[model samples]
Target: MFTEARLYSPVTRTGDGDVTVHLSEEHPGVRDPEYRARRNAIAALALEYVPGAALPRIDYTEDEQRVWRTVSVELARKHRRYACTDILDAAARLALPTARIPQLDEVSAALAPLTGFRYVPAAGLVPLREFFGSFAERTFHSTQYIRHHSAPLYTPEPDAVHEIVGHATQLACPRFAAVYETAGAAVARLRTDAALKFLADVFWFSMEFGVVRERGEIRCYGAGLLSSYGEIEEFRGAELRPLDVRAMGTATYDITHYQPVLYCAESVTHLEDVVGEFFATIDDETPARMRARPVSPRPAAAARPRGSA
Candidate 1:
């Protein structure tokens, strides 16, 4: 029930060569014609992209830049409190622009020296294999569109903010970038849909939404939480379970709301041992082999974090 597809809206091309981003009824931009036009225009840039060409650039509007500025400033403040040292240090080194929306090329330029990772445009949902597989080549498929200007802190799907702010920062970290590349290699090794889904499931929990303990506090490294204005503040309150690859891969979660539960690594070292090792050795048979074993009982909640339960 929890396919990664649910996290994105569909983009389609018309016979007339126009692009349309089909927004759900609940999307904040669904009723705004101007916002819909913006989405379609940006999606067009991605659709028209050619491999090895320079990444598309969006001359973001004044309002769009304001949203980026507001969220970036706010998220930066929260990052100091909730982000892990790995992310914090890497972010300092990357130093993404806080006053405006940086283009994909700019992000790639900054990351080129640090992690050798570059950004490619995505119209919307990238096929799981292609999306994950790109990482093996040190390339990341990214969306260039900012979220609806009305909701500076909320988006129903991944936007440039989430891609650049959330993932680009992670990609800047050498350790985190290595894991991403390894996960891409794991994707290349898998031959079955189930195995691919299993890999994606694990990715969702670890790379996208995982947490780690640092300085006696539960800090976030996952892009999903790191880019989010609200989720970052609320993740520590979720039911904290120990990091277990099988558990994370098999677990089902809702994407429409704040996550009610999250897995925690005892430390960054613990994260590398369990999560990093899992990605490095995973194969097509790994999913069934691990799933066939009896599912372990969920570990009890981790020790209450320093600030709140």
Candidate 2:
């Protein structure tokens, strides 16, 4: 089981002149040479892309297009049923093509007017600072490769479908966009690794795996849930606790399986007010102060973060 303390596994090269993209055991095409080459090549393209310049283009193969369409259509159904109203409204605005994979440049162009955010290329692990810090400039460094075609519905890592469909959908939503913008601004002020990691954990819970109650139903707004074909259906079954910043910052989680715990906002406005406000004020001192608290309250429904005895 993996936690979100650091970047996902890095890409490595072997003496045999082959590349290995570190992935979870569930990754379907791990042993496929073709997929490995394709992934490594696209990652190279991301490396060459210059910040603030036009993003590099990716020419998807027929098989890759098939993979995109399959996951797109399947996740669409799950999104409508499981997604929050604002996220669905943003999806309507995006009207992303289901028949083909849109290049990151195109995704950037579409998102420009909506949130002033743009997609940039990312080969592998973008140092945590540059990755999240770029948000202050409204840039998202996204991975270009599609997941292995063998399992269109699942990916061991964040692939194209997860980046564009999951995040682009929410970013186009003004309410959610504001949340990220504030987060970006927060990172600009946070210099310590302790503080930045604290912010990322909160985001992982609220923006990545957060749920909210609306009209008497608990539905999802997080990108991790929106784009996940299988996990989206299972989050409602995870332990649902009310939003609590202290619990979230210290919480540990396994990234490789269905998340066993999640936080819920009382409503969309509550999520925006609570999480958004916290993001707006994070600083180097915030982490130390939170940890120094004499008696931090426990999350009601979920167990302690990963590694807690």
- Best candidate, TM-score-wise? 1
Error of 2 at 13 (Å): 7.3
| Location of the lowest summed lDDT over 10 successive residues in candidate 1 | 300-309
Question: What does candidate 1's lDDT look like per residue over 203-266, in tens digits?
Answer: 8888988999888899999999999888888898889888888888888676776766788998
Tens-digit per-residue lDDT, 1-309, candidate 2: 124433344776567745556665545776787887788878767765676677788889999999989888988998888888999889998889999999988898899888888888877677767877888788787888888887777676788887899889988988998898889889889889889889888999999888999888899999888888878877887888789876788776767567788899988899988899999988999978987776555554543222100
The segments of candidate 1 whose C-alpha lies over 4 angstroms from its true place after superposition are: 298-309
Q: Poorest 10 consecutive residues of model 2 by lDDT?
A: 300-309
Clashes of 1: 0
> How many angstroms is residue 93 displaced in model 1 relative to the true structure, after the best TM-score fit?
0.3
lDDT of each: 0.88, 0.81
Model 2: number of backbone collisions: 2
